[model samples]
Target chain A: MKKLSETKEKRSNLSKRIWADRQLYFMLIPFLLFYVIFVYKPMWGLQVAFKDYNIFKGMSGSPWVGFENFKTIFGNPYFFRILRNTLLISTYSLIFSFPMPIILALLLNEVRIRKFKSLVQTCTYLPYFISTVVVAGMVTSFLAPSTGMVNLILAKLGFEKIYFLSKPEYFRTIFITQGIWQNAGYSSIVYIAALGGIDMELYDAAMVDGCGRWKQTLHVTLPGLLPTIVTLFIISVGNILNVGYEKIILLYQPATYETADVISTYVYRLGVEQANYGVSTAMGLFNSVVGFVFVYAANKISNKINGMGLW
Target chain B: MTMRTRGEKIFGIFNAILLTAIAMVCIYPFIYILAVSLSDAKSVNMGAVWLLPKGINLNSYSQIVHKEGIWTAYLNSFFYMFMGTAVSMALTTLGAYALSKKRLVGHRFLNLFVVFTMWFNAGMIPMYLNFKNMGMLDNRWAIIFGFAINTYNFVILRTYFANVPQALEEAAKIDGASDFKVLLKIYLPLAVPSLATVALFYAVERWNSYFWPMILLKSDSKIPLQVVLKKMVVDMSSRMDSLNYGRDMTGTSEDGFIYSTMVIAMIPMLILYPFIQRYFVKGVMVGSVKG
Candidate 1:
């Protein structure tokens, strides 16, 4: 009876606190309402992955198919191909595109000319703002057989013109190179800012120790950037399976699908193009689960190693 | 200041030269595109237009202005950018402000809820289905309200709001100012630069976004500039494809037309590049520090 009264008193205290904060709660109403509709509602709709979702039948009216959709996806041979493609593209991107910004930042940081530095930054950063459509279009035009700049250069060099876009072997290189071109400068902003935060005294001390500029960079600047690099790296690891399909969809053609067809693009083709909602949702759910696992593992490893976590 | 060694001087010169080459490479594609677009069709076809225009003409540009649905697509894009940014800023500000307060009810859970959406989402199929179910397919409101707040921007704004001097809030409370009034009169005024950063982020996203609009909006009348540009530049044949574009500019060539369209689409962004360049570094810094 005494314990029950103590619990009652705590409940009343919480109620009083909530009443005092009613105004703050009122301010959050619209945000919460929209959040539920836009975010949580879709999360709720994940149930369709289990159901044999028919567009006309609606989500609720659709018949439940248990794990049949999941079975179908696993049973299909194409799923494995897409999975392999997804992993390869993301791994290639991680290997090739990840270090570009850091390299650019380090290169830019070594320059003492303010005007030259800003001009380079401005030129490089311009591509990040260009739409994916435009970028993909530019890629196509630049790789065109006869009139394209690349082919023209090849001809001038006395080499036979190659249709770079149609070749499966060339797809990953083109995609990775385009990713670097579009993003390297903009991604360097974080590193540039981090570079700015390093103390002048460290460089001075390094200089006093007879360290040259390169040595000072290797010792002082690199160590200073370690935390930022680690954090960004962990984030990228979590996103290893989440290759964006927008650019891939824009760039890929039938001839190049052998190398270019990732899981997200396959899901896109199934759901939007074919109207196969049930199987597509199951694949999507699978992707999300894998993505969540990657994030959880990355966070766990990060916490164990450095006492830092995404949470 | 100590005098630089010869080695240091040489290294500096090499660095400058390398960086200049990189910058030139970065900007050269756009220059080439512009050159190709302005040159006559024969020169472009013969690969004669390399770094500069030959037989330069404004025919493609003038032709694009008269193209059907181009003006409508531009108007649609502008509308989306303005309305979408406004809604996003409002929602993000309110949500971030309330969540910023440690004393607020369910504060921890609310913050987690916002950030969790970043790590794991329902993916594309469910999202598209949800919009379709809500009769939002082909609707303009779908474009605006569908993606109201980006969580990264929310976190950045919330961090800025949380760092606002609590002493100012205490002073405002003593004046008997309500939470909403205090937010508008105090927090909003103090958070202009941060707000601009987030707003610009939303504006650029809204402008450049084509995926959802391509999927959700079916009607030609409602599609954005990027979609229209994609149709002409990427999918269509670009040789003698100018017959349907305009009558007087019949021989202007579709190759030239595609380049012109790309240039036109890029003009707005290039104009706003300076403004965007100013705030993104600060914005990125805040997020990185908090992380």
Candidate 2:
């Protein structure tokens, strides 16, 4: 009887607390409903990837054909090409674009002139705010054969004006260069902040030890930046497959598709443009699973190396 | 300051020169586009318009102002930016405020519920189908309500809210203020800078949005400025000879029209960039510290 009374009292207390926070709970309803409908509902809709979806019969009435779409995608040679393109572009980004911001930050940090540093930062960061469409558009125009500035410069230098966009060989270079130009400065903000946080005492200690600027950077500054770099590198590894398909879709042509097309763009072409729903969803599911595994594995490795992995 | 060594002086001069060169390279594209847009068709075709306008003309600008779809798309973009940001702010603010309170029921679970969406999502087709199922296809609500809350922005706001003093809330509560009243009377005022940062993030996102609007909206009339600009600037790039615009107009050219449209599309962002710049460092710093 005493235990039952204690349980009832606890239950009443919970109810009373809930009642007191009713308005707060009410405030969360719209956001929760949004998540339920838009976010969680899509997870449920991943079932269509497994099922042979019939548009007329809707998502529920679709027949299950476990892994058929996956098998079909794997059987195609084009799928392998897409996968290669995705990996190549991602790896190129990692190798080239990843180190840019760090280099930029280090370079900028060594500048004693505040005005020059700020001006450089402001100019470099401006491109990041420009729409992807505009950037791709500018890229297209700048590489145009006849009237393009690049071609004009080449002609002035006595080299033949080449159509850069149509050449598959030039696509990856253009893409990677454009990525660096657009993002490097904006991305340097984090590293700049990290640089600011390095202890001044340590720098003074290094100075007393007869260190030059370059030696101080090598010993003290680099060590201070190591944690931030490791964390960012891990995050970049996790995002290896997500190569901004929006820009690719904007920039790439049919001629350059061999080198430029990535998995997401292919999924878009199949699912939205052609209305091949089931196969496309399966492809998308594959992409998501691979991305998730990469993130999970990277997180696990980071945790093993240092106890600072994202939980 | 210590006396500078000769090597240090040389390095500083070289660094200054290199940084100046980089800044010039960065700004050159915008200048080229602007110059090309303003130059005469004849000069542009002659490839003489480099770095500066030759035979300057405002015909392209005039044509854009008078164009049928351009103004409509511009208005549509502004509408989306304002309306989308408003809805997003409401959802994010309410959600952040609720979750920031440690005493809230299911606090840990609710926080997890939101943050989990950040790490994983069902990808494009599933999301597209969900929109199709919800009757959001070709709808403005697909653009607005479809992406009402970004997890990063939500996390930023929540972190800001979590750092607010508990004593202020208690004091408000003692004065018989309700939860909503306390939030409005106390928290909202203090969180303006953070709120502005998130709002600008959403607004700029809505403004620059191309992919979803291109995919979701089927009708030409419903498309945003970015889509319209894409059709003009990018689509026309491959088929330059097929461009039929400005043939009758004296000073206008195919590239000029395209470049002008890009400039107009870029104008709003360039105007708002200073304000956006101020908040970016602060917002990113705060977000990195807690989120």
Lowest lDDT 10-residue stretch of candidate 1 chain B = B240-249
| lDDT values for all models | 0.87, 0.88
Candidate DockQ values, in order, are 0.51, 0.55
List, residue by residue over A202-279, the lDDT tens digit for candidate 2. Answer: 989988898888888999999999988897799789989888999998888888999999999999999998988999
| Minimal lDDT window, size 10, model 1 chain A | A302-311
Q: What is candidate 2's CA lDDT for residue B94?
A: 99
User: Model 1, range B91-137, lDDT digits (tens) per residue?
Assistant: 99998999999987689998887788888889898999889989999
Task: Identify the runs in model 2 with alpha carbons over 4 angstroms from their true place.
Answer: A303-311, B240-252
TM-score of chain B of each: 0.93, 0.94
User: Chain A structural similarity (TM-score) per candidate?
Assistant: 0.94, 0.96
Per-residue lDDT of candidate 1, residues A78-171 (tens digit): 9888999999998988898999899999999988889989999999988999899889889988887667789888989999877777779999
Candidate 2: residue B86 lDDT (0-100): 98
- TM-score for chain B in model 2: 0.94
Worst-scoring 10-residue span by lDDT in model 2 chain B: B243-252
C-alpha lDDT of residue B71 in model 1: 83
